[model samples]
Target: MKLKFDSFLLALLIAIGLAYFFPQAVLFQDGKFIEAVTTVGVSLIFFFYGLKLSITDIKYGLKNWKLHVVVQLTTFMLFPLLVLPFKSFVANAVQENFWLSFFFLAALPSTVSSSVVMVSIAKGNVPAAIFNASVSGLIGVIVTPLWMSLFLDFHTENVFGDVYWGLIREIIIPVILGLLLQRYLGGWASKYSIRLAQFDKTVILLIVYSSFADSFSSGVFRTISTSYLVYVFIGVSVLFALIYGILYVLTKYVLKFSVVDQITAIFCGSKKSLTHGSVFGKFLFLNNPSAGLYFLPLMIYHAFQIFLVTIIARRYHRRKEEESQ
Candidate 1:
C-alpha cells in the first residue's frame, strides 16, 4: 500500500518541533558539524533523486514540450516578475534584507519530486512534469545565482565563490552518472525510490530543523512576533491564491490546455522550490547563521502553495473523472 504523504508532512512538523524545542541539541553545538551534516544529508537526497529518474522517463518527458515550457517558464520566471513589484512595496514598509530575499526565492526552480508527484497524482502529464521539474532544477543552479547576482547583488560582494560547484556536482553530476549507468542502476532505483521518498522527507525536515535551530541559537525567534507571523501567513496565502488564479485563467482560457495540462501547469508553476531556496540560500547569506532570514518568508509561501494547490489538483482530478464518465 502507498503511504499517505500527509504523514511525512506531519513527521516533518514534529522534527521541526524537536529542533525548535531543543535549541541546544548536539547538532547545533558545533557549527561545522551542523554544516557538514546538512551538506551530506542534502547530497544524499539528490543522489537518490538521480537514481530515481531513468532513461525511459527522460525520453517520455521529452514528448510534451509545450507542457514543459509553459509550466517551467511560469515557475522560474513569471512568478518572480509578479513578486518583484511587491519588493518596492515591502522595501518601503519593511527593513529586513533577508525578507526581501524572498523575492529571489520565487524565481528559483521547482521541487524535484513534489511537482512531478502532484501532477502524476492529479493524472496530468507526469512525464513532462518530471522533465520540466528536473530541467528547471539544472537551470536553477546556474540561472538562480546569476539572477541573484543581477537582482540581489550577491556577486558584487564575491559571495559566489568556493564549494558551491560541489552542490551542483552532487545533484546534477550524479543524475548524469545515474543516466550513464541506468542499465545497472535502474533496477535498484525503482526498489529504493519509496524508501528514499521517506528519506527525502526526512532530509527536508533535517534542513528545516537545522536551519531553524540556527535561528534559535542566535535568538532570532525573539525578533519574530505573533503579529509578524500573522502578517507573513496572510501575505503568503494571498500570493499563493493570486499565482494560481492567474495561471488558471491563462491555462484554461488563453492557452486552452486540456484540464489535466492546466492543473499540471498551475500546480508546477505556482510552487516555490524549498530545496533550492534553502540550499542556495546558504551561499547568498554565507557566514551568517541568520541566513534563515532569507528562508523565513519563502517558507511560509511553500506551505501555502502546497495547501492551495492540493485543493486545486483534487478539483481538477474530479473534473477530469466526471468528463471521462
Candidate 2:
C-alpha cells in the first residue's frame, strides 16, 4: 500500500510560507477588509455546521449512552487533566502561552468529519461516531471557554462577559440560526456537503494565513527559538500517542466495549478539530499578537492525528477483511 499525504496540510504550510514572505499583503487598507471577511467566513462555517447537524441521528444514537459518555469525558476531561499537571512547570509569560496552547488543544472537541470517516473506515459504529462527533462541538462551545478562564487573565475588565459574547455572536448565534433553518435547507446542505467542506477548509486556510501574518508582522515569533519549536512539535506528537494509548486501554479493557465501539471510542476520543480551533481561537485570542503561536500545537496535532488514524483505520480494515476471508 502507498502512503497518502493530506493536501490541505500542504496548503497550510504554503499559507504560512506566504505569510512569511508577504506579511504586508495580508492587510489591505488598514486590514479592515480581511478582518471583516474572516469574521463573516467564521460565522458561515458554523452555520453550515448547524445545517448539516442531524437531530434524528443524535436521538437515535442516544441509546449508546456508555459509548457517548466515554468519548465526551475523554475529550472534555481526560485530555485536559493529563496536561493540567504541567501548569506548575511554566515559569514565564512565554512558556505560559506555549503551555496554554497545548491546553487549548487538549480542550478542543474531536473533528467531526475525520472522526466519522476513520470510524467508518475501520467498520466501527458509524451512527454513534456521527452523533459523538456532532455533539462534541456543541459541548466545546461551553466547556472550552470554561477551561481557558481558569488559567487565562484577560486584558479586559469584563473579560468573562466578552468571551461569551464573542462566542455567542461568532459561533452560538450562527449555529442556532442554522439549526432553526435546518429543516428547510438541511437537505440542500447535505447535497452540497462536499462543497461546503471545501468552503470550511478555505476559511480555515484564510484564518491561518491572517494569524501567521499578524504574528510575523508583530515579531512575536522572534521570542520563540528553534529548539523550543522542536520541543513543542515533539510534545504534540507524544500527547497524541499518549491519548491514543490511554483511550485504547480504556475502551478495550476498563469499559469492555465491543470491538466496533472500542474502535469508535479510541478514534473519536483521541482526535482534535482544527476547524473549531480556528474559529474559537479567533474569539478567544482576539487582539493577541501571538495568536498564531497558540495555534501551532493544534495545527501539529491536527496533521498528526489524521495521519496516524488513517494508518490505524487501514490496519483495522485489513484485519476485518482477513477475518471474513
Candidate 3:
C-alpha cells in the first residue's frame, strides 16, 4: 500500500507560511473586511452543519447510550484529565502559552466530519458517529469555555458572559437558523455536502491564515525555539496515542461492544476539532497577541490525528474485508 499525503494539511502549512511572510495581508485590521468575511464564513459553516443533521438519525443514535456516553466522556473528561496532571511539569519545563495550548487541545470536542468519516471507513456505527460528532460540538460550545475559564483570566470584566454571547451569535444562533430552515434546505445541503465541506475547509484555512498573521506580526513565534516545537509535537503525539489506546481497550474488552461499536468508540473518542478550536479561540483570546500560540497544538494535533487514523482505518478496513472473505 502507498501512503497518501493530505492536500489540506499542505494548504494549512502554506497558509501559515503566507502569514509569516505577509502578515499585513491576512491580519484582521480592527475587525474590518477580513474579519467580517471570516465571521460570516464561520456562521455559514455551522448553519450548514445544522442543515445536515437529521433529527430522526439523532433520535435513533440515542439508543446506543453506552457508546455515546463513553465517547463524550473520553472527549470532554478523560482528555482534559490526562493533560491536567502535567500542569506542574509544563509550568516547569515549558512556557505558559504552550501549556494553555495543550489544555485547549484536550478540551476541544471531536471533529464533526472526520470522526464520522473515520468510523464509516472502519465500518462502524455511522448514525451513532454522526449523532455523537454533531452533539459534541454543541456540548463543546458550553463545556470548552467553562474549562478554559478556570485557568485563563480574561481581559474583559464579564468574560464568561461575553464568551457565551459570542457562541450564541457566531455558532448557536446560526445553527438554530439552519435547523429551522432544514425542511426547505436539507436536500440542497445534502446534495452539496462535498462542496460545502470544501467551503468549510476554506473558511478554516482563512482563519488559520489570519491567526498566524497576527502571531507573526506580534513576534510571538520568535520567542520559541525549533526544539521546543519538537517537544510539543512529541507531547501531542503521545496524548493522541494514549487516548486511542485507552479507548481501544475500554470499547473492545471492558464494554464488550461489537467490533463496529468498538471502531466508533476508538475513532470518535480519540479525536479533536480544529474547526471549533479556531472559531472559539477567536472570541476567547480576542486581542490577545499570543493567540497564535494557542492554535499551534491544535493544528499539530489535527494533522497528526488525520495521518494516524487514516492508517488505522485502512487496517481495520482490510481486516474486515479478509474476515468477510
Candidate 4:
C-alpha cells in the first residue's frame, strides 16, 4: 500500500516555508491587528465546539468513571510527568525554549476530531471518546496554564490575573455563550462541522505562519542545528511510543477494559491538540521571540501521531471486521 500524506500537514509545511521566505506578510504587526484576528478565530472555534457538544453525551460518558479517570490522568498528569524528568537534559542540550516547547506539548489536551475519528475507526467507545476529547480541551484551558505557571513566572506583577483573564475572554466565555445558544444553533453547527473544522485549520495555519515568521526574522531558529531538530523528532516519537505502550497495557490488562474502551483510552490519552496548542500559545507566549520554537514540537508531534495512529487504527478496524465476518 502507498503511504498517504495528510493535507493539513502539507499546509503546515507550506505555512512554515512562507513564513521563512516572506516574514513581512505573515508576521504580527505593532497594532495587534493580526493578534485580534487570531483571538476572534479562537473564540469562534470554541463557540462552534460548544455548539456541537451534547449534554446527554457528556452524562453518558461520565457513567464510565474508571475509564474517564484513566484517560484524564494520562492526558494531564502522566504526560507532563513523563517530560519533567528531561527538563535539565533538554535545557543543557538545546536551550530552555526546547524544554518549554516539549512541556507545552505535554500539557495540551487531546485532539477532539482526530481522537474521536480514530476511536470510531477502531470500533472503540465513541461516546466516551467524544466526551473525553471535548472535556480535555476545556480542562486544558485551566490546567495547562497552571502547569506552565509552575515553572515560568507568567505574571510577575498580577500573578494569576492575566492568565485567567485570557482564558476567560478567549476560551471560557465563548464556549459558555455557545452552550447557551446550543438549543438554537446546535443543529446548524452539527450540519456544518466540516466547514468549521476547515476554518479551525485555517486559523491554525495563520497562527503558524505568523509565529514562524517572527521566529525566522528574530533569528530564534538559528541557535539550533539541524541535528538538534532530528533529536527533537526522535524525542517526540519516543514520547508517543512510551505513552501509547503504557496506556495499551494498563487499559488492556490492569484496568481490564473492553477492547472498545481500550482503543478509546489509548488513542485519546496519547494524542495532543494542535488547535489548542496554536491558540493558547498565542496568548501564553505573546511578545516572546521563542514563540515559533514553542510550536515546533507540537507540529512535529501532531504530524507523527496522526501518521502512526492512522496505521494502528486501520489495523484494529480491519481485525474487527474480520472477526465479525
After superposition, candidate 3 runs with Cα above 4 Å error: 27-29, 92-94
Listed in order, each prediction's TM-score against the native is: 0.87, 0.96, 0.96, 0.96
Which lDDT value does model 2 have at 282? 81
Lowest-lDDT window of 10 residues in candidate 2? 151-160
lDDT of 1 by residue, 1-325 (tens): 2223566557656765786788677354466777677677777767666666655776887877777888778877787777676655545323454446567667678877778778876888777777777788778877777666655544543556543575575567766776677677777878877887777666667667776676777776677668776776776777677777888899899989987777778878877787777777666555555655566667767766667667666766777789889
Candidate 2 residue-wise lDDT, 167-222, digit = tens: 78888899899999999999999999999999999999998998899999999999
Q: How do the residues 234-316 of candidate 4 rate in per-residue lDDT, one tens digit apiece?
A: 88998999999999899998989999999999999999999999988887787777889899999999999999999999999
Candidate 1 global CA lDDT score: 0.70
**Candidate 2: deviation at residue 252, Å?**
0.8
- Candidate 1 residue-wise lDDT at 173: 74
Cα lDDT listed for each candidate: 0.70, 0.90, 0.90, 0.89
- lDDT of the structure predicted as candidate 4: 0.89
Instruction: Give model 4's TM-score versus the native structure.
Output: 0.96
For model 4, what is the alpha-carbon lDDT of residue 62? 83
Enumerate clash totals for all models, in the order shown.
0, 0, 0, 0
- Model 1 ranges off by over 4 Å: 1-5, 26-29, 90-94, 151-153
Task: Give the Å error, residue 86, model 1.
Answer: 2.4
lDDT string, candidate 3, 54-163, tens digits: 89988989999999999999999999999988787655423788888999999999998899889888899999998999999999999999899988886469877988
Better of 1 and 2 by TM-score: 2
- For model 2, what is the error of residue 190's alpha carbon versus the real structure, in angstroms, after optimal superposition? 2.0
lDDT over C-alpha atoms for residue 94 of model 4: 48
